[model samples]
Target: MFIAIVPAYNEEKRIVTVIEKLEGHVDRIVVIDDSSFDNTVSLARNAGAIVLEHTVNRGQGAALETGHAYARSVGAEFVLHFDGDDQMDPHDIAPALAYMKEKKAQALIGSRRLDEHSTVPWFKRHILLPIGKMINHFFVRERLSDVHNGFRILHKSVLDSIVIEQDKMAHATEIPAKIIAKKIAFVEFPVTFTYHEYGQGTLSGFTIIKDLLFSKFISK
Candidate 1:
């Protein structure tokens, strides 16, 4: 089975659209509603997604972990992690899966930098992302073009191997760290993100850095 796991929080406005875009791309769509205060859960269910609820607002990482567990329990052969916000292009899903098969990689991560035409914001492309890349390299020791992108696909073996411990944005770095630690064959694929009014701002970058640094400090 193929499953797409979406971690959502108060994304009622775009949740249905995200699910709609995902339809026919994967066998099952699982939406982990991280204690959304809006109509996200009901909207997602109405859109034909298998909705999983969190009583409290766990971070995106924790929500993804919940989705991961459910995916594994259902014997999913491939699992895709997609954000609830309508940023990532669902059209990239097929090519990414094909590339994974072609490269014989157990996992594939989407990279905006790999696509020359990707319209990344100036500050993000020139400043924030570069700094984030450096920090992630320090932690994972792998030079991934895009470290914090939420779009990725993992084979069953990878799903069984890595565990997401950082229950926040730091889980971005943690995922690659564990993937590298386990020596999983992974590759990066070109993908586009359509920025909108609700996209993450500059401050979130610092938050991610703080979380990563704190998590690293405690893990030692």
Candidate 2:
């Protein structure tokens, strides 16, 4: 079965809309509420998602790992990792899945840079993302068009192969790094993003790097 896993943290305003957009796109919708204080769990349950709750606020990566474990438990054939915020375009889901099937790939990551129509902010488009991309390449030893895009689809086999140990934003790098290390067959599909003011700031990039280094250090 196809499943979409959304990791949400106090996203009451947009969780319902995100769930609504995903309704018919995937067979099942799983929302991992990372100890949200708001009505996120109630709202997601009302929106027809299988809601999973964390006792405390772990980071996005930990929430995703929780969702992954549940998906695997239920024998999910394919899994899509979607953000709880309304930034991702649900319309891109079908095309991305189709592309994955067409290429016979085990995984697919969304890339805004692949589409000329994608309107990325100037600083992110030119500077922040480039630095992130380089850092990911250095760690993962793989070159990808977009290293930090959260929209991704993975076959169940791929899911079984990699483990997400980074509990925070560093999983953005760690996921790809693990995938590359396992020699997973993957591709990048063009996807659109709607950047909001609440999005991660420039300083968050440094935080991600720090988390990544710490994760690597601990792994060693």
Candidate 3:
């Protein structure tokens, strides 16, 4: 069985649409509400997704870990981690899953480099990208065009082998490191990058830099 695991946090604006997009593509959908203050949980439940909520906001890592555990519990053969903000396009799911089965990979990452102009913020491309590349090259010893993208598909084995401890945004940077450390069989396929309406709020340029510094140097 295939399962979609969505880690959401106060994503009342776009979570429903994301779930709708996943319909018919997977066997079941699991929404891990990270203690969203809004009606995220109720919206997801109403949308026909199994909703699980954290008592308090434990962070993205915890949310994702929770989703993964639930997916495994249900005996999912392939599990996909999709963002609640609709940054990842649902169209890439079929091909990515096909590629995973063809390659027999333990984990599959949907890379966003294929897009001519990545929807990722400019600061992320200029600053965070470099820091991520440096960390991957030095610590992980692998070259990845997109390191922190939330769009990913993986086998239960990889999820079982690795554990995410960083209960924050840094989980994006840390997940690949753990995958590399374990020498898991993983592959990446180019996928589209487009942030949706949820990203309407303007983020200062420094915010990306600050998160990168914290995740790369301090949080680790």
lDDT (Cα atoms) of all candidates against the true structure = 0.90, 0.90, 0.80
Per-residue error at 84 for model 1, in Å?
Answer: 0.9
The clash count of every prediction, one per candidate, is 0, 0, 0
Candidate 3 lDDT, 140-211, residue by residue in tens: 568887766788888889878887766766677667878888999888888887855434122422343355
**The CA-based lDDT of model 1 is what?**
0.90
Model 3 lowest lDDT segment of ten: 197-206
Error of model 3, residue 154, in angstroms: 0.9
Candidate 2 ranges beyond 4 A from true positions: none
Alpha-carbon RMSD of each model: 1.5, 1.2, 3.7
Query: How are the candidates ranked when ordered by TM-score, highest leading?
Result: 2, 1, 3
lDDT of 2 at 73: 98
Residue pairs with backbone atoms closer than 3 Å in model 3 (clashes): none
Model 1, span 106-200: residue lDDT tens: 99988988877567888778887888888889888989988688899999999898888889888888898899999999999999888876355
